[model samples]
Target chain A: MRRAKFKAAAVAFIASATLASATLASAPAQAEIASGAVLANTCFSCHGTDGKSAGDMPTIAGKSEDFITRKLKAFKSGELEATIMNRIAKGFTDEEIAALAKFFSRR
Target chain B: MTELTRRGFNKGLGATTALGALSLSGIAPATAAGKAQVVVVGGGFGGATAAKYIKRFDPKIGVTLVEPSKRFVTCPFSNTVIGGLNTIDYITHGYDALKGLGVEVVHDSAAAVDGAKKQVRLAGGGSIGFDRCIVAPGVDFRWEAIEGLDAGTAARIPHAWKAGAQTLLLRKQLEAMADGGVFVISPPVNPFRCPPGPGERISLVASYFKTAKPRSKIIVLDPKEKFSKEGLFKEGWAALYPGMIEYRNLAEDGLVRRVDPASRTLYTDFGEETGDVVNFIPAQKAGKIAQVSGLADKTEWCPIHPRSFESTLQPGVHVIGDASIAAPMPKSAFTASTQAKVCAEAVVNLLRGAAPGAPKFINVCYSLVGENYGISVAMVYGYRDGRIVKIEGSGGLSPSGATPEFRRKEADYTRGWYESISRDIWG
Candidate 1:
């Protein structure tokens, strides 16, 4: 039953994404959104997909954009206490951090 | 192809309605308009993750993962198996999950790569064409590095470095040894796969002896003056397994020049030493396939473009994992998987005739000092000028002088990372 739900959800997501792509095809300007999912997949190696936490790691999904941005910047700046986040955050540029913040906030 | 775009044009309808139709129909949209073929060799962390991410990025791009083995045994947690903390089955994974993501998982060895023809020849006698080839064949030992240490000798004196039969062999050797027996470990020089792996194994073995064979002692004859997480590992050895582990650096004549499996003895410049069980991890180079395929040059490791992981020696071919010389980024499983993501994106972008994007790679390696004590090192890297550069103040070792509670927490995090990374790659 869980597998069935997951497949259904996957189909729904692909369908919506396909629709979004189609809607933006006429306006190429709007199609320039960064591929957040591509980069975010790396984070799933520790944090769960879409910033969901599977273990002790904090869940970033649905967090306020400003909160996510602040935390990432702090980690990048070495102003935050973290086991691995500071290192991982340093890999991202300011633009990427903002894009990820926006992506996760929507999740 | 037109049908896909036509379906996309139905965006005039509400997203909920489109999703409802998609769910009821059980049809996944085409990933892209153009169909590109990506052939990946070696279905380990790098290859498997690359195939999955490529399909995720653009399902229209066909991905064929060529790995001889049906199931992959990971090196990350295999040390626990040697320590009897976990079973071999716990670290083994199949490619079914990757297949589910629309990747063609071919259980055949990539015998050779034809750069000009853009074809990968299989060991079974056939060639598969590819628009781009990604090779992630992990490291192979330089058999001649140590005298009298080859395949047959390695069976008796196990390396246990590749994480399958050798791991079990080492475990058996340990189990058969008598109490108070000496277990000698010969760690290879730098530029080897998993810099901290040997130290972690020693810690776990010491942990096992702490309970099972209290009188047994472990002696590490290391070639290098210092090793990854040297301070943390030494501290843990002192705190947890006092008087059980002894490390001899190169300055102290620790380098093993030769080994005699018949006598179970190691010969160093200083003198000779014998042990009941000996683990002689050898110096490493790129995998045999990479060498034969011309991906690796005289360096015995593949050089690649830092931004894309494309082979600098071979165009239209990308090399990653332990086989690739990603300097400043040690050859580690975490780095391999991270490189795979960036390589996947680069392959897709190249297929679309766009320049590859600038990439950021991160590596995190966790070492278990005891069953409940862990230490880690992490780094964030980016391509600058013409090489991979570590971002300053980005990562460091697990803090020193922490309480037991802190170490225990890091241990939990270690297990969590293992589970998460394994699932991300294969689950």
Candidate 2:
């Protein structure tokens, strides 16, 4: 069991290093689109981009990632009452929700 | 489901690697070093959002927004202005935010496009070149479709579709109306901007009558059999403004063949109807600039590739907003902004020689049925088989028997949505 856990950690480390290198490699060529920003942009139609809201809509920028994740999951599951967020949240996959949470949280 | 294992996660990354490799080969080299010129026309929701997003995606791409007007009045919440719930200034915005974002704001109309030369001619005798051009001129009324309802007559029987002086005119007419007066709203056929717009206007007018002119009646003459959020609008009308509002479908005395603006009478196939105030929303086509520039094809609107929103008829130019043929997705400010982002990404990817990613579009239209009562319809769209198709099991209408509290919350959401979207475009 200890050997297997060590192997898994090595594989994870290698994978992350490869991704980081690949991102750096593509940065100069401008071949990689900002996937998180592009995905988060869709919300700009109803929520300002980078989560800076203008009116009654609360800003999501700088919020805890866990808080956004919990609120989005509640919206997705229809547990929390919403006007349009429920329907919108239902459209995102779990992967997309995490990506969006990470994107907005960083802002 | 359990969390993805390391192997599974690595496999997903491997797929992304393949996609990136493909993108590297697919994109062509951009024209200039360190600065790519992206020109956007019409400074509305689509153009403004496209300009903002393109700059956000890559600061190196210099964006120039060409718009004749300095201030943009949104159509989303203009109905509330007509209903006396909000003021026009509340829906109006300026382009200062976009300018502060390093976008070159050109206060001039685009007269024509030299597509081959990759340049746009200004109406007031100037020319600007572009590496990529995005046109989002919104919609223009087809005045010839209705007899005696040209621009001059429209001043008398206001359409209030463009959300400025027309909106104020309609409000003034409503205010001048008698207590038991009749208010007539003639809605054009499908494929127009904001499908639920007429219905929402009717609700707001009814709300105003309930308080100001209780005996007043509203008549909606629709050219279609059904409308967006039909059931919800009907239910709210019945519950809130009982016996005060009447909806006539095309099959039932709804089609207005002609109008005599001098008499304030609308002649239909069934009979003649007069009103104290008339709103004649005429048939619509792509904005005049799209047609004159050869972007619009045989269809009244411009045809575009569903994925890139680039005009299929005109290369090197992208068309968005109500002017593009984006059916299944209604012609709305929200859809325009959404399409703008997708188009912006495509433009950037193509400039940088990267493959454009798959496109997903979402539309949520909220309609206020009465004071503190609203309903909505939402859908998700995916590009497949060379066309945009609705995603199954995603998005639907508001519940049929929702509580008043739910509807009131929706109303609040409507206001919030307007604030959010307006700021996204102009703030």
Candidate 3:
């Protein structure tokens, strides 16, 4: 009985450590998206690269992550308001939304 | 059967509710930085603001914003679409604002969020890891509660509560209605998005009909006995639209029970209502994503840290905007923006390992009654003890029936605010 308990504890610790290491590995990729210059291609159609809005488009350079996430969710859930953007936004997943927020916030 | 005290949630949330603080400890302390990656769901006023604010307060802390759309339409001024004051195009904005801010702006929906794993999984396939996460995904239409009402019924019945296409559809329906026909508008129970929204929408639509379709009448059915800006709306209804606008304050007995799309009829608990057009705004809860994430309680809303807006369900996960149980604060764009700022400040403070001081909440809701008549309310709030407490009487109605000039000035301020706030969130 003692041996079984010890084996289970060791297995749990190893699994936890593996999960922790895996989580740590992907985080830097997110950092790279924020600090690096990878997302410019996706932008500029409406916002213009410098955060200067085009026509009635909003300037989003210095916004908070929470603000951005709420708006996007509105687009997803069919709450809030949108037109064509809702159709376009239909393509992004939650992870991509996070990546976009991180990249733009860094810029 | 352990009666789920919070009827809708699992046994875990029940305990967490009894001890909201206990479960929060299992998660990383809000803003803790061990290079912790935080995931934020949604991209509206709250989600957008949280993402931008998190990065602003702490540069090293990694943040991800999961939103389904690249662009968002402004609900604040959407009524203008119905009034012919503006087009839907005028209110739309892409995620360019967030992308420019260096945010990872995803363009898809979040399928689920496993609070235990601190992961937000997308509907597509993969999932992302997070030390902390935030959800501001707005509300969903409660299609089940209303008989004979589903998305199809809404298409013909026209519930523009969600904005976007629904707003346009309601507007189009209004435009198509007979000149002398009856148009019925229903306001959902309170604590819904934009408390004064239904009132504002009715007034704006009435204003349009006054000039365009003079013979038409607008009947408003409300579930609540009272509403935001009631005194002002009543005063204006008497002076301006008079008999053209009628209101029925329906209590529980008067709840809308069924909808008939073909005849344009709404059968309420009180009686059957018929109109050339029917607009039903149903009772709502948090976004489906929030519910799936297990952040929602019996209220179908996420409970959060009053100051940080962080979700109590999962550590590092925060909720803001219409989905959160932020009382004394209406679900307005202005209120969302204010809450977003506080959440941003709290997230920043937490990330820096600095204890959050007393955080303040601010909000101002402005509504345009007639062409030039405008009314507004503003207030500031702070954390008291463990709960949120509002500073009373700090604001009031627009001086209780002020002059036309005063109302006009209020209108101007209203316009200015829309410009500034849109910039504050998207910029």
Candidate 4:
């Protein structure tokens, strides 16, 4: 029952994110999506289809922009330690990093 | 193709078996004229974070990351893998992220450091000079602590404690055990990576086998009598994976004295404990590279100015993650990642001839106690009077005696955090 709810909620989140992105909120951060998508390619590999893991992966599909940005900044900046994430995140551009936060938060 | 080029260069240099402190000797004598050369060792948390930041913070600061492997697998959340929550491939990553960021990625082993001369001897018979350096080499196993255990034995009975293939290796072995097989976990002594990691791991592993291999059971032997999140784990184990888990504290000889893989048995000081599959997370210290760099003092870890994370024995270098003696924080990935950021800011300030003062550190570790039931501990800290001290308003543990609802929420938060943190570090 609990797992079912989680799956439903996750599906709802992805659907909402997809729906919402089409309207294209012109938040300055959202504008950097193309570049952020490129940088996010490294992440999308483990994080899975559009930051939504098949329930096994974490959902970066919809989070606060700065929150995602700060964390990536943390990894890139070394404020956090995740073996793969830290190594991979550290290689992003300042603009790319910002764009990633924006991309995932909006997704 | 870069791997082939590197192989050609090393063989051309007639290098045989690269060993010593990890270094970068491929630096081409600073022909770039006035650019600052920054060489980072270790491709794990600290080194990778520093290399990327140096390039972005000052792209002119030529950053060369000298690591033995082109790809690195993380140890954080690897418990999920050990527990069958995920796989190593999903958790593994490569240097393409860093390379894309315009950081020079050098796939070489650091042989030795000439800190005074600001140079690193490469494993491939060359010397790479640097203006400053960062060493985040993870850790190494202390093979001789147990009576009959060493690196060789670990291959037979993995300490999958460090993630990567070792984690999967142990998991595969566990999953293949007989229905009623005894799966034993030997937790390491104090000052090891991710203190809460083992208990979280055992619980998650037990969850998988409960349905798949109902008759299987687990036995945990530890060097310490008590542990962090003790109540929560015991409570969850009893209610969830009951009769499938047992714990023995080693103050009463809980330490495994010897092991014979052929016999599939482990002998603790208290008595003999045998299992179809055994997981041993042995005593640990900074990996060989950090040790060779003369960075680690007593405790076999680096001593650094908590505020800056700069090595006490060496200037122009900083150490973070499990290799450094960072108290007021557990040796977890979050702490390392946090320490990495603090170190990054400080290193940037130092490079720019600015000031690095009283930097704050934060850590929050979440462990999945059972399916969708997670617990955590969090704290915020600052370097005070030459020590890292926790800030009052910042952190706390998962609420005790909370609703199942609360626990489940923590699971969601943990996942969200992983997403948040992954994007922070890699995105």
Instruction: Give Cα-based local distance difference scores for all models.
Output: 0.81, 0.81, 0.66, 0.68
Candidate 4 displacement at residue A60 in angstroms: 12
lDDT string, candidate 4, B1-427, tens digits: 1223322322321121111112333332232236777788877766776676666555667788898876677777777787788877767778877887878888999887667678888898897877667888778888777767788887778998776778888888977888888888888888888888888988988987887788888888888888878888888888788788988886666778888876768897658887889888888998787788898897888887675677878766778888888887788777776676566655554443333422445466778887688887766564445577765544556656778877787776667666555545554
Per-residue lDDT of B19 in model 1: 43
lDDT by residue (B77-183, candidate 2, tens digit) is: 89999999999999889989998999999999999876667789999898998777999999999998898889899789999989788989999999999999999
Off by over 4 Å in 3: A1-107, B1-35, B251-254
* Candidate with better DockQ, 3 vs 4: 4
DockQ of each: 0.19, 0.33, 0.02, 0.03
Scoring the B chain of model 3 against the true B chain gives a TM-score of 0.90
Tell me the docking grade of candidate 3. Answer: incorrect
RMSD (Å) of each candidate, 1 decimal:
10.1, 5.9, 15.0, 13.9
Error of 4 at B27 (Å): 20
lDDT of each residue in B1-427, candidate 1, tens digit only: 2334333432322233234324533332212334778999999989998998888777878999999999999999999999999999999999999999899989999999876677999999999987789999999999899998998888899999998888999999999988999999999987899999999999999989999999999989999999999999999999999999888999998999999999999999978889999999999999999999999989799998776688877777899889998899999998899899988986776565433544667788999999999899988786556568897767778888988988898888888878888887898
Give the DockQ of candidate 2: 0.33
What lDDT score goes with residue B188 in model 3? 86
Instruction: Please report the candidate that would top TM-score against the real structure.
Output: 2
What is each model's TM-score for chain A?
A: 0.66, 0.70, 0.58, 0.60
Question: Which window of ten consecutive residues has the lowest lDDT sum in model 2 chain A?
Answer: A20-29
